[model samples]
Target: MSVIIRKSLLELIFSGAFMKRWNDKLRPMELVEVDKQGHKMIVAWLLFLLNSKGMDVARKRALGESIIEGGIYDYLYRLIITDIKPPVFYRIKENPDDYRTLSNWVLDQLKPRIMPLGEGFMRGMSEYLMQPEDKGLARRILNAAHLYASYSEFKLLKSINTMDHELTEIEDSFVSRLEALRDLKGVSELLNENDNVLGRFARMCGRLRYQKRWSQTPRVPETSVLGHMFIVASYSWFFSMEVGACRARCQNNFFSGLFHDLPELLTRDIISPVKGASQEIGDLIHEYENIELERVVLTPLRDGGYAEIADRLEYFLGLEVGSEFKATINRDGEVIEASDAKLAGEYNLDTLDPKDGPLLKVSDSIAAYIEAHTALKNGISSDQLHQALYRIQQTYKEKPVIAGVQVSALLADFD
Candidate 1:
């Protein structure tokens, strides 16, 4: 199958917004799948940082892709197996025959919509879901991330649901599952340990759920910065696959998209309007974000013996290049900025550890368009959103292609 990103695939990614978690229990705030996936990926990254010390880039890429795909497979399966209690789901897993029968149904339902991603990707996803006994490190990392994110939500529920009969069991379940992974490099420190650097980092990432995008404008089913990051990451990976980017570039793009707005966690969601109002204002905000990002997040990680994470983050955020959206390649341990044309023509190779910054920028804009268009369709009306949708459409209207993908045409799907 040729690589393709169709409307169905995009919608499949966005459908997470409609799938609520903890629906069976009382919840203070709405817990949706997208936000949880976002949080899970962040935690997974932190875990990777912890355990992947001295790991080679190729192995790191493989681990990262596995985590990304595993999360996707879990999300798709859960979309079909909605609202099943955890114990019941675990019981179903224990019975291989029953679980296989159900998962096969899900794969069948998903086949058509997912096939456009190419046969290799479809195979990977199927293999991940069909095997009920994958206890590999990637699987463990994903499980730990899932538990960590779910525990975050459970903390909220415990505040108001003290009288609920299931509260104790739920709390015990979370503790047991997390404790099972204490042997992992960072899990022990992360378990209710606030001062640990990794713990503090993951907590800060979780706090992004409280930061809303387009904070000034009211929109239906409001989106958080955390959720938006995951959306962009997913889009970039899809586009990366379509463009035949190297394996390293694909992971780099996905993770770059994942953490591109991380500074916003410290600065809050500063809208583009304010950033673009004046060059001085933009530069000031940019400088402030970098200084704070390093002092608060990166420095602590490096000082705490996790320089790998900080280095990778700086590379992903393109700190030296001055913009995450700038195309770059590493040549013999030296970072070289490349033009979009140069990247496509001469540097689309895995050995370069390339990043398609131009393509990621496209993905970022496409995510923004989706957010605005979805809100407009959701019966919300505001001048800010209207102008935003119009602006994105107009900007892409004449640009027929980006990184070999027809991005302008992609936007037209919404119109």
Candidate 2:
């Protein structure tokens, strides 16, 4: 029963939309290639969090010296530089004071798209880890992350010029309407402060471009783990849209999918075959990931008093939950109790079931299928690729739906 549920969930995580993310080209280079930006942004955000010690120190100094909070300024700066789309950014650059107003407008547009998942994870931090006084700070950080995740895709879209000319023009005009506010005195002061942390983190994320995915697959374009996460997150958002998921559910699915492979940063991309080599081996790998994640990722943040950020990562990555498949099902195929229930009972009462585990599983499988499919299309014949494609298709042969998504139809589109 658990196997069935796990299988279904994997299928959702690898859904066609997720896979298509890999195919989405990014550029500004000689090579006609780049991995999806959505995944890259997830890694970027994680890096930002990991490298935020300097920012935290700066914020502390500001508070002690009776200076205004520099944290908010740092947040805005990072968001503008990292996630703000080119079309909108050009406008924001022209008028920095309107940054607050324009940012809200941009977020509104991104709400139905990819920001919700990041938003949910941010909100999770405030709810679970932070003190009341720090909740506002948590929210500001969330806004930054959310904005980055949303606009991250535009880097690729603009590079490839994928959208129609008319649509591009419309987007440009829409952002240009906001008049430039001349005075940015407060913002300017904040911006003048040192931002070594942000710079270091941004550079670290940039290195992911060199950390190629599917290293064994020949004749395939190089993909970075960073890019893959963005794609998965975006795909999860699209899948949520397709299934008419509630706002909260959509956020959960997007974030869960976005950070699903985060442990790979410390562990590298440990391929599935090695993980599935044996039950004991799989369990051991999982154990190692948990340990490394805590040591290399979560512990430093917690020690630095950014426990909220660490907690949010654990939640989104399923570290806190133990299993990616959150629901317990019996042989009769009824949910006995979901992981969320256990969480709510143990933690905050406001905690709600994300109901996205199954969807994430499907998205995962779809992503795998597309990777195999793309390899095959490139004439890179590998037994593993062929078998993976066949296995996924075979597994879903009679499975028509999971989490309200038409499984058969989704697979058929790939066919």
Candidate 3:
């Protein structure tokens, strides 16, 4: 593809009428005219509004303001005026209610609108949005779409009825944290309340898989992070129960599994090569992430009045503030001897001990096998399947902890 096509596509992604015109695959010059011009005009108008001072000054000014300031304000303003197109602003000054519905309709129209973006762009966007001193119009866009609300707004909107509004001193505390996550934009899109707990749990599992390894796959059928979460959560629940675990453990494991990858919402899933770089490089990335989480995740949670929610999540993960370290504990308490019929043994605390480690490990492995198997079933080469099988078997062989179990057989059974 030419640079013009690439540039036009980038411009089209942010265009209001993009969906209407997208299938045409119009000429690069036409695309440039439509998308680029529209963006520039809209951004220019916003810059004039924000920084042009009085009306007389605004009208007389011929020269444009800085694109940076204007672009930022335009993005923020668009968020506040979600669904209300630039055209509507001209007509709705007199009818707020009609404009409100029109605005909502516009956003609803975009909800089903999906876009396929590269992992590089996705991660960049996440990092860009997660800054503490951040100013993102997209987040505001999400908020205006009613995908998110302040904690108080959520409380009012949800009518959360309960005698005890605050967390009891002895309660798990994570419950409050989970409650805080209730109103985040894109979160509900990711989680499900209509589905049974197992169903909801499954969604979380799918997300974890996507977070760890999205680029390895050629294409993501449903490209949103939320969609990926839903699938993984389902598989995790199914495999967990199949392994003879009880309902509660499975649910907790499933939830933990889902949330295990939540940070990726901010970090984006860093591929293995970039992540496995030199110690200094890795540490630098880690440090950058620490800064971002504090700015993006932590502060947002606080501003949203769900500080307790963030606190609980950190506690559950056994992590402290200002650090990205997460603890994943094994299921079945301590590591047990593979041959020991009693299945009891020493507890290993010197390593990662996240609550969902074992379950996530199993879920992750099963998902890989299932994905590869599905591909083969759909006519992926036998050679490809064999390669996947080799990797799966080797992984099981190396991970002595999981080798004792029947994970490979379970995946094969599914196949």
Candidate 4:
């Protein structure tokens, strides 16, 4: 099915950046919807990685699709409800007729904007939203991830809110809810263990929420590196559908976009201008990033028996093939680079475990452009933002198509 792609749809997804998480409580740093969603997805994937030891590709794909689609639905619903307390929302959900009415309204609002994602996506969203009692493994994983992400944020605020009575209650609630999921395959193993590998890795990703993007310039609804990654991941998924990417290619692109700047978690967000100062400086920074990435992320995962996870991450980052922006695939344990044309043609099979690196680059750039453009639209302009937008547009101006999508035309739509 052909789906329309437009500015409003992408902007709708980006709007999550402005939706503050835990609005009623005091936070050491701002916790926004985008960052929370990003962290949740990361945790979900981490849990999925370990728990899905013997699952078939089809089942994995279905569950993965559910996680992604369910997340989108959750975000959209949260946006409409606008800071309703969980208890109150639960009350609303308890009334089947009322819940159905409310959910349908949400789908109505989302349909026009998200219909472009395709009929199946909207159908999944509607079905998932209307049926609130989904007890599948995918749902369990999402539930576990949700509590983990929220609990991680609670830790950040716990230091300052030590005396607040409600803080203790919230903490207990999070623990109880998470403990309830101990029945789930990997939840107990990881969460029950002290300073376990998955816990450490998830916490590392949570820290990305603190690393703000565009550090050199101020912008309205400031986005963190974590939030930016989520946007890129989201865009990559939608674009993958738009271009008819294979299952593995779509999965690879989404995850690659998700973790593209993960190295920045250690080094912080390095502005492009500083990196672009000289070729040597850029190379030095790249070299340093790889060193730190291996030492901190890969080494720990490998040591903890999550080497497959580590290796897959390395592949997504294109550690062996060069820049993460280069198209590549894994065939019988060998990392082979390919062109966008080949990815769309010969290497589209799932067994190749292909990743569309160039398409992922386009997703990354378009996400940045949207960030700058949104900031300007929100009336918090700076030369940095303007220059960033201009540079992206100029870069794509001569290229009408990129990774099977109309890159120049899409950029022109924003004009």
Among the numbered candidates, top lDDT falls to 1
Clashing pairs in 1: none
lDDT of 4 by residue, 320-407 (tens): 9879999998889999999889989999988898888878888888889988988899899699999999888888887768889788
Residue-level error in angstroms, candidate 3, position 181: 17
lDDT of 1: 0.86
Error of 1 at 277 (Å): 1.2
How well is each residue in 338-414 modelled by candidate 1, as lDDT tens digits? 97777776788888888878888888898888888888899999999999988777777777687777988888777
Q: What lDDT score belongs to each candidate, Candidate 1 first?
A: 0.86, 0.49, 0.37, 0.85
Per-residue lDDT tens digits of candidate 2, residues 37-73?
Answer: 3433443344334434456544532221111112222
Per-candidate alpha-carbon RMSD to the true structure: 1.5, 12.7, 21.7, 1.5
lDDT (Cα, tens digit) per residue for candidate 3, span 1-415: 1011121221222232121211222222111112222223222222222333344632323222222222322332343354443234646644656655644554344322211223332333334333323434333322222221112112232333234443232133323443444443334432342343322322322333223344555432212333233234434444443444333334434444334445565578775357766878877777776677567556655565445445534543334422222223334544222211111123222122323345556655555555455555556465645676677767765653441245544444443
Judge candidate 4 at residue 71 and give its lDDT.
76
**TM-score against native, each model:** 0.96, 0.54, 0.39, 0.96
Candidate 2, superposed: residue stretches over 4 Å from native: 1-36, 43-207, 327-355
Off by over 4 Å in 4: 189-194
Each candidate structure's count of clashing pairs: 0, 27, 18, 0
